[model samples]
Target chain A: MIRRGLLFVIIVAALALAPPATAERLIVSLSTHRVLINSNFTGTELVLFGAIELADPDILDRRGYDVVVTVRGPQRNFITRRKAQVLGIWINAESREFVEVPAYLAVSSNRPFAEIAETEFLRRSRIGIDYNILTQRIGTDIADVVPQDPFRVGFVRVMRAEGMFSETPNGVTFLSSTHFRTTVPIPGSAPTGTYEVETLLIANGALVTRETTAVEVVKQGFEALVAQAARDQRLAYGLLTALLALLTGLFASLVFRRD
Target chain B: MRRLERRRPFGPERAHVSIYLPIAELPVNLFVILGLGIAVGFISGMFGVGGGFLMTPLLILTGVPPAVAVASVPSNMAANSMSGTISYWRKRLVDIALGLVLLSGGVVGTAAGVWVFGVLRRAGQLDLAVSLSYVVLLGIVGSLMLTESVRAILRAQRGEPPVVRRPGTHAWFHGLPLKLRFRQSRIYVSAMPVTAIGFAVGFLGALIGVGGGFMLIPALIYLMRVPTTVAIGTSLLLVLVTNLIATVLHAVENRTVDAVLAFTLMIGGVVGAQFGARAGQAMRAEQLRLLLALLVLAVGVRVGVDLITRPADPFSVVATETFQ
Candidate 1:
C-alpha cells in the first residue's frame, strides 16, 4: 500500500511538471456564484477576482500580464436575415442560421483585445464578441461559415443594442501585480442558465494560462414555480390559464349584474 | 466593516418589483404590464374588437419576443370575450344554434391552423407568412368597412329610409346545396358556406394573433344577415372558444406563453373592459364605426409600410431556443 501510494504521488508530480503551460496558473472566483432571479430582480453585477498562483521574480520582464474576463450565458441557435432591395422594397433576401452562440455574452479586458492577442487566436478561442458565433447550420454548410457575412454582423448589432453582448476595454483593473478584478453587469433580459466566467491570462502576446468558474442564474420563489410549470407541465398550465379566464368571466358577470 | 459591505457581490436592492417573464426571458416593471393590459383592454371594449392585433405589436415593441407576444395575447382575449359574451347572453341576444354550428367548424380549423403554425415556425416561414397575411387581410377588410360605413353615414344624412328585411328567410347564399334553416338568424342557407366562412376566419385568426371578432361580426351582418345584437354575442362566443384553443396550442406546443405576464395583463384587462363598455355607450354607433375603420386602416398601413420600406437593420435574428 505504501509503495502504491508513493507511485501515485510520483505520477502526479511527473504530470504536473510535464507541461507547466497546460496547468492553470491563475486562480479565479466570483464573489457571488449563484444569482437568484426573483420577481424583484432587475439587474445585477458580478465581481470576479483572480490571482496568479506562482510568483516569479522576472514577471515584469516576462512581457507583463494581460487579463481577459468573459461571462457567457446559455447557448442558443439564431437565424439571422439579411435584407436586400428588390424592386425598390427591402425584404429578407438572404439568411443564415447560426448555432451554439451564447444567448448573452460580456467581455472585459485589461486593455484592447487586439493588444493582448492576435485576431486569429482571439477568434479561435472566441475571446471577443466579434468572433463568438457559429453561423451556417442551415441554408449553407459548415465549411462555408468562415469569412463572416452580413447576417452574422446583424446578430451582433442586435444583441449589442439589447445590451446582451458587450465589450468594455479597460474593464479589468489590477489591484496589484498578481491580482486582477472585473465587474460584469447582468442585464435584465439575461436568460436563466449556468453562466461561465472565464479569465484568460496572457503573457508575451500569448495565452499562458486560464481559469473558469460557473455562476448559475435561476428563478426563485413564485417566479421559479411559474417558469417550471410553463415548461414542465405545459398542458396542465395551459388548461389552468383557460379555466381561470372562464371562471373570471363567470364571476364578474354575477358580481356586476344589474337588472 | 464598511469596506466589507462595499465589496458585496451584488448591488443595492431595487425599490420597485420587476416581474420576470419566463417565455419572454425578460424582467419588466409590474405596473408597466398591467398598464399595457388596461390600455389594450380599453381599445378592445370601445371598438368591440379582440385587440390582439394591437396588443401583440405593442408587446413586441416593449421588448417581448415576437413568439411570446403572439402566444400570450390569446389568454387575455379569452377573458375579455367570455365577459362580453356573458353580458350579451343575459340580454338574450345570443343565437346559440348559429353560434354552435360556426364553433364546431372553428374548433377543427383552429386545431389544424395550430399544427400548420408549428410546421411553419420550424421552417422559419411563420413571420414572413404572418406579416404578409396581416397586410392582405387587414388592408382589404379595413378599406371595405371604411367605404361601407361612410356610405351609411351619407345615406343617413340624406334621410333615406332604413332597409328592411323579413326574418326566417334567406337571400344571399340561398341557392347552394346542403340547406339548413337557422331559426334564430331566420335564414335558410347551406351549411357548407357557413362552415367555410367559420373555417377561414378561425384559421386566419390562429395564424395571426387575433380573436376573429372584428372580421367575424361584419361577415355575420353582411353575408349571413345576422341581426347586429345577435351577431355581437355570437362573435364573442366564437372568439372565446377559438382564443382558448390558440392559447393552449401556443402554451403546450411552442412553450411561449408566460403565465405571469398573462396574469398581470388580465388584472388590468378585466377591469378596463368594464370601463370601456361604459364609455362606449356614450358614443354614437356611426362615430364608433368610423373611428374603428380609421384605426384598422392605420394599423394595416403601418404593417404594409414595414414590408415596403427599407428596414433600418436589414437583418433580424430569431434565437431558436435549445432547452438544454
Candidate 2:
C-alpha cells in the first residue's frame, strides 16, 4: 500500500512539472523517408508539411510564427586546395583540410534569417548556410588560434558553386496560421548518406521549440552493387573490369567478320 | 469515387530506372551509358583503335571522377580492341612476331612509365607533365599522319603508282643487327629498332592510360615500314597485351577500376563494333587512313585548347582516396 501511494504521488508531481498539454505546438510529417536512385534519377524534391498548434487565442488572431527548415547531409572530411600562379600557370599552392563537415547542406527560412533571429541565435542554431556549421578539426589550424574563417569561407563558396550548398531566405511558405510547408531540393550530384532535417519554431522574435528528423539517401540496383564492390572488393572489381573489356572486344571482333 | 492523383513536378521517386556507377558514385540513365558505349565502340571498330582517348574524356565530361575515368577507360578500350584483334587475326593480317617483339618492349616501357608517373605525381606535376606530353605527341603524330595520308590520297587520285616501302628497301634499317623476319608483314628489320619503337609506344601508353593502337599504327607503318593491314592488326594485338597488363596494375595498385562502368560501356561497344567493321570494309584504305589522320588531329587541337585557355577558377580540389 505504501509503494502504490508513493508511485501515485510521483505521477502527480511529474504531471504538474510538465508543460501545459495545450502548449503542444509542433506537429510534423515528411512526405517520404527514403530517396531511391535508379537509372532515371535526375534529382529529387521533398515536401515537408507541418502544423503549429497554439494555446493562445491572440496568436491565431495575428500571424502564426516563423519557420526555418535546414537539411544537411552526412559529415565527412574534405581537403580544399587553393591555386596560385606559378610560372605563368595555375597550380595548387595552399591546402586546407577539414573534418566532420557536411558533404551537402541546404538552408531555407520563411524570411531572411537575419530578420527572424539575432546573429547569436542564428549561429547557435546554424539556421543559415554559412553560420550553422559543425566544424571539428581543420588541417590548417596554424597557431591553433589564428582565424580559420578564410579557408572556411572558401569551402562554402566552392560547395555553393558545385550546387552542394544552397540557401534561400524565403523558401518556406505559410499557408495559414496553423500550417506551413517547404520544399527541399536534392541535386543529382548529392552524395549518398543520411540527411538531417531540422524544423525550428519561432515566436515573438524569440526562440521556440525545434524538431529534428532524419532521412536517408542511398543508391540501389546495379549501381549500388558496383560501388559496394569497389569498396569491399577492389582487386576483384578491377580484374573484372579488365576482363570485361577484353571479352567485349573479342566478342565484337568475332561477331562482325565480313570475310 | 476515386480522387485523381496529382503528379509532382520532379522527384527521383518518379524515375523508372537508373544505372548506378560504383566508382564514379553516381547514377546514369541506362540508355545514355549504352548509347555512349555504342558510339565509342563503332569508332573503335572502324579505325582499329582502342577508343580510350575518346571514352575517358567523354566520361569525364559526363561527370565521372577523373581518377576513375583514367583508371577504367583502358580496360574498356582493351575489350573493344580485343574484338578487333580477333577479327584481324582470323584474316591472317596480324604480324604475330612483330606484335610479340613490340609487346616485350612495351612491358619494359610500361614499368618505366609507371615509375615516372609515380615521381611526377608525388611532385604534384603529373597533370602538367601529362598534358604537355599529350600536346607535343599529338601535334607531331597528327601532322605526320595528315601529310602522309594526303600524299597517298593524291597519288591514288592521279592513278600513279603508290609508293610501297618493301622489304630491304631502307638499307639503313636492313643493316641493323639482330634482324628478324615477320612473314606476315613481309619485312626483315632489326629487333633493336622494333623493340625500341615498341618501348616508346608502351611507355607513352602507360603514362597516358589510353590504348596504344592509334599512336602505334602510324609508327609501325612509317618507321619500321610495316604494311597498313599488318600494322593495324599488330597494333591492336600489342594494345591488347599492354592494356590487359595496365588494367591489372591499376586494379591492384590504384584500385581505380570500376567494373560496372567498364562493362556498361563495353556492352554497347561490342555490339556496335560489328556494324562499324562492316562500314569500314566499304571504304578504301587511303580514305580510311585520311579519316583516321583527321580524327587524330582533332584530339590534338582539343587538348591544345585546354592547355592555353583561361580557367574560370585558378583553384581546384584534388580529393585523395585516403577516405576511400
Which predicted model would earn the best DockQ?
1
Give candidate 1 misplaced runs (Cα > 4 Å): A1-25, A53-63, A85-90, A120-125, A131-135, A138-147, B1-17, B164-172, B322-324
Off by over 4 Å in 2: A1-25, A55-64, A82-94, A134-154, B1-18, B108-130, B166-180, B190-193, B321-323
Could you say which candidate leads in lDDT?
1
Q: Write the per-residue lDDT of candidate 2 for residues B262-318, one digit (tens) a residue.
A: 788888888877777778889987788788778777876776666566555544443
- Clashing residue pairs for model 1: B168-B186
Residue B160, candidate 1: Cα error in Å is 3.2
What lDDT tens digits, residue by residue, belong to model 2 across residues A168-218? 889988898678899988877677889999899986566667888888988
Local error of candidate 1 at residue B42 (angstroms): 1.5
Residue A89 Cα positional deviation in candidate 1, in Å, after optimal superposition: 4.9
lDDT of 1 at B117: 76
TM-score of chain A of each: 0.81, 0.86
- Estimate, for each residue in B79-125, the C-alpha lDDT of model 1 and write its tens digit: 88888888888888888878878888888888777777778777666
